[model samples]
Target: MRTLAAIVLICTATAPQAHPHIFIDTGLTAIVDDAGALQAVKVTWAYDAFYSLLITEDYGLDPDGNAVLTPDEEAQLRGFDMQWIEGFDGDLVARLDGGSLELSRPRDVTLVMREGRLVTTHVRDVAGTPAMAGHILSMKPFDPTYYTSYDVTMNVRVQGLEGCAIVRNLPDLDAGMQQLQGALTKLGRDQDAIEEGFPEVGEAFATEVEITCADR
Candidate 1:
C-alpha cells in the first residue's frame, strides 16, 4: 500500500497534470485577537472520498476502517508537511484593501480522518492586520497549474466575530469554457501532451470569497 506522502509526490512529479486529479472542499475562518482585530486565517481542506480512500489504503487502514488516526499515525500524518516551493506564494490567494497580502507559511498544521474523509488544517497569519472597519478582504484557493481543484464547503463559518459575513462568487462559465477551448486548440490533437503542457496555460479558475465586516 502506498502512503499518503507518496500520493502527493506522484502528483507533483507529473508535470502539466490535468486539472483536478485531487478534489478538496476548502473552508476559511478568520481569527481575531482580543481587540477584535483580525489575526490570521484558518484554512481547512477536506479531501474527497476517492482520494481519502487512496490515502487510507496507502496507510494500511482497513476497507471498513472509519479513518480514525492513532497518536503515532497522527504525528506521521502531520509530519508530511505540505509547504509550497520556495518563493511560491502558495495556493491560498488573498487581498486586503485591494492589495495582495503576503501570507506566511501555514503553522499549526494538523491532519485527521473524519467520517472516512481526510481533513487537513493550518493557520496563515495576515502579514499585518490593519484597522479594517470598512475594508473588504477577498480570498480564493487555486492552483495556477490546475492540478488540484478547491471548493468551499457550504458550512463555511466565521469565528471570533459577529458582524462578519462571507460572500462567495460563482465560477464564470463562459470564461471557463473559453479557457478550455483555448487549451484544447493549443494542444492541437496531441492528447498525450494535454497533461504535460496544460500547466503553462495558467489560471485554473476559482470561486472567490469576499469577507466583509461591518464598521466596528
Candidate 2:
C-alpha cells in the first residue's frame, strides 16, 4: 500500500508540474491601421518576473497623425511594478495598467501624456490605498556599441516608494531571484529572446533595461 500511495501522489502532482508557465490573458493584440502602423497594442499579462512579456508588437507610424517621437526615442518600451512583484514578497501587482487590461480592482490610474512627456497618477499598491509615486524617469537606448537584441532599455527613477525606503536596485539580481511569485510560466529572463523576436514585446529598444537614480 505504501508504493500505491507514492504512485498516487506522483500522478496528482504530475499534471500541474508538467505545464509550462507561459501565461496568456485578456489583452493580447496589436491593432494596425491601413498603413500597417500599430495603432493600439495590448496584452493579457501575468506578473512573475522571469523575463515575461505582456502583449507586445511592432510599432509604426499612425495614419490618424504622425506618431511624434522624440529624437531620443529608441526601439523598446519598459514598465516596472507589474510583474516585478516576484522580486518582492507580500507585495502584489497593482494599479497603472488600467483600462484595456481587465482587472479585479475597481480603481483607475490617470496617465498624462503631453507633447513628449508622460506622467502617471492614481497608481497605488495592491496591498494598500495610496498613490504609488512622486518618481520621475527617462529612458533611452542602453548602448550604442552594438545593435543585436530587442531588450527593453529602461531608466527607473524611484522617488517615493511604499515605505519611503531607499529606492534602489538590489545589487544582486540572481541572489534575489527567488523573491518572485507567479504562475511559474513567468519566472525567468531570456536575453536572447529580448534580442530575437517577441510576438508581444517589440524590437530591441536598447541593450538592457537600465535603472537610474541619485541613490535615494
Index of the highest-lDDT prediction: 1
Instruction: Let me know the TM-score candidate 1 reaches against the reference structure.
Output: 0.79
Residue 97 alpha-carbon offset, candidate 1, angstroms: 2.2
| Root-mean-square deviation of Cα positions for candidate 2 versus the true structure, in angstroms | 18.6
Query: lDDT tens digits, residues 17-94, model 2?
Result: 312122111112222233322232222223222212121213332223333333333222323223333333211111
lDDT of each: 0.67, 0.25
TM-score of each: 0.79, 0.21
Task: Write the residue-wise lDDT of candidate 1 on 153-183 in tens digits.
Answer: 6355556667777798866645654564466
Candidate that scores best on TM-score: 1
Error of 1 at 79 (Å): 4.2
For model 1, give the 10-residue run with minimal summed lDDT: 1-10
Where in model 2 is the C-alpha error above 4 Å?
A: 1-61, 64-66, 69-106, 112-122, 125-165, 169-171, 174-216
